[model samples]
Target chain A: DQQVKQNSPSLSVQEGRISILNCDYTNSMFDYFLWYKKYPAEGPTFLISISSIKDKNEDGRFTVFLNKSAKHLSLHIVPSQPGDSAVYFCAAPLDTGANSKLTFGKGITLSVRP
Target chain B: DAMVIQNPRYQVTQFGKPVTLSCSQTLNHNVMYWYQQKSSQAPKLLFHYYDKDFNNEADTPDNFQSRRPNTSFCFLDIRSPGLGDAAMYLCATSGTGDYGYTFGSGTRLTVV
Candidate 1:
């Protein structure tokens, strides 16, 4: 089973609409979570992050909400733009000490139709 | 921009051929990692180096090996290429203390 799961493979929304992407985790020990955006021919970039202590973090048009009890999290992009069309990945850090590697979910592709 | 560079982004090899993908980072991070991404799947961590110490994934094949000769350069070596090994290989680096990684444009390996 995937430790982190992105159930939706593809999501399409019109420009200026809210795009919500969801993720679930099976591991309760995950203390940190992150979201990354990737474009074709380019590597994934760090977008935002949240700690288990807080439920929400907002960075401009993007906000990440975490629900520890449900073992779920979501990335919300407000007024989605055509430029926002890309693959999004959710990641959790394994407790592998100081140089821990991140475990990622199969990415979700967002299509913001203009 | 602290960029991560991958040489020979596109590579083609015979089934039994050996191939090496390279990555270099300007970030000067002490931790560097190699990941393999297949079609319709997330990037999987193959192994990593914390300075000179090598850490490998348990599921990674014996044919797959990695080397970090120095802090700036890392190489992923495939001793005998197999059809299943054809995929995008990514290199990433992060601060040993920060753990926030920066990734490079991947090397797409095609086994014919």
Candidate 2:
């Protein structure tokens, strides 16, 4: 069973515009959510994260909004740049233990057109 | 620069042959994890080591085994590789309480 799901396989947006990627989860025990950006042949780099207690978190051009009641989260990039193109993964922990194991979505490929 | 390092960016092994993938971390993190990622698929957890204790995923195949000799090094041993085992292997590290993990570039394994 896929606990975390990224419904959209890919997204395209014009440069200087906004790009939004959505993710959903069925597990209610997950208290933290994180987004990672990956480029071709490279490892994933941590982007932004949000706790269940907070509805939103932002880092520079990246912002993550979480809705605990709906078990959904979205990542928004404003004024998207061509360099922002990459695969984005949404992940959540299976449990809240000291050694938490993360479960990731299939990932969404984001393309920022110049 | 402290980082997670995975050796042999690429490897080719004959079917039914044994192969070992190595990982090391200079980050001095307490936790290390191994993940297997097939093409166009999400990374799957194989196992992890918290300090000296090793933990394996229930679904991980018995053909796969891991060893952490110390805090700085870990190894994944495939006793008998199959064609379906071809994939990218990732190593990650994190501090005790930190939820954020740093991952290596990953090693691509090909079973011919």
Candidate 3:
């Protein structure tokens, strides 16, 4: 069973506008979450992350909001650029111990239009 | 620059043939991981090496094996490649399992 899920297969947004991507998970013990962006024929790059202890984290134009009680998280990019278009994946891990496996959600493809 | 590198970014192997994919990291991290991503699906972990200890995911096929001779490099061996095994293999490194892991460009395996 997939513990993490990104229901949206793809999304399109106009350039210089805000873009929002959503993700959900079922496991409560997972204390950490990360988002990675990938381009065609390239590896996924680390984007932004947030600890379960906090509700939000921001890095430049990107921000991640987490709702621990709802087991949900969302990634927001302000003034989205064409260069930001790619597949975004959300992943989570339980801890540094044996349950250390990272569960990933199916990626969401974002397209920026001019 | 510190990064993860995969050799022979692309590989073509015939059915029942054996192939090996290599990965090297200059990040000097303590944990390394292997993942298989099919088309648009999420990457699934195949195994990992924590320092000298090796850990394999329970669902990883027996046909697939991994070896980490040293901290700097790791290899994935496919015993008899099948058409269904064609996918992108990714190598990653992390300071700890709880943090964001850096991924390599990935090796695309094409089984003919």
Winning candidate number (DockQ)? 1
- Distance (Å) between predicted and true CA of A84, model 2? 1.0
> Native contacts retained per candidate?
0.70, 0.47, 0.57
Ranking by DockQ: 1, 2, 3
lDDT of 1 by residue, A17-106 (tens): 999999999999998899999998778899998989999999999999999999999999998999999999999988844557999999
Looking at model 3 chain A, report the run of 10 residues with the lowest lDDT sum: A93-102
Question: What TM-score does the A-chain of candidate 2 achieve?
Answer: 0.97
For each candidate, report its DockQ versus the true two-chain complex: 0.74, 0.65, 0.57
The positional error of residue A13 in candidate 1, measured at the CA in angstroms, is: 0.4
Clashes per candidate, residues 3 or more apart or on different chains: 0, 0, 0
Worst 10 residues of 1 chain B by lDDT: B93-102
Candidate 3 at residue A72, lDDT? 98
Name the regions of candidate 1 deviating beyond 4 angstroms: A96-98
Tens-place lDDT per residue, model 1, B15-108, is 9898999999998999999999998898999999989999999999999999888889999999999999999999999885774688999899
Q: What is the C-alpha lDDT profile of model 3 across A72-97, one tens digit per residue?
A: 99999998999999999999985644
DockQ of 1: 0.74
Per-residue lDDT tens digits of candidate 2, residues A1-114?
A: 899999899999999999999999999989999999999888898999999989999999999999999999999999899999999999998888545878899899999999
TM-score of 2: 0.97
lDDT of each candidate versus the true structure: 0.92, 0.92, 0.92
The CAPRI class of candidate 1 is medium
lDDT of residue B35 for candidate 1: 93
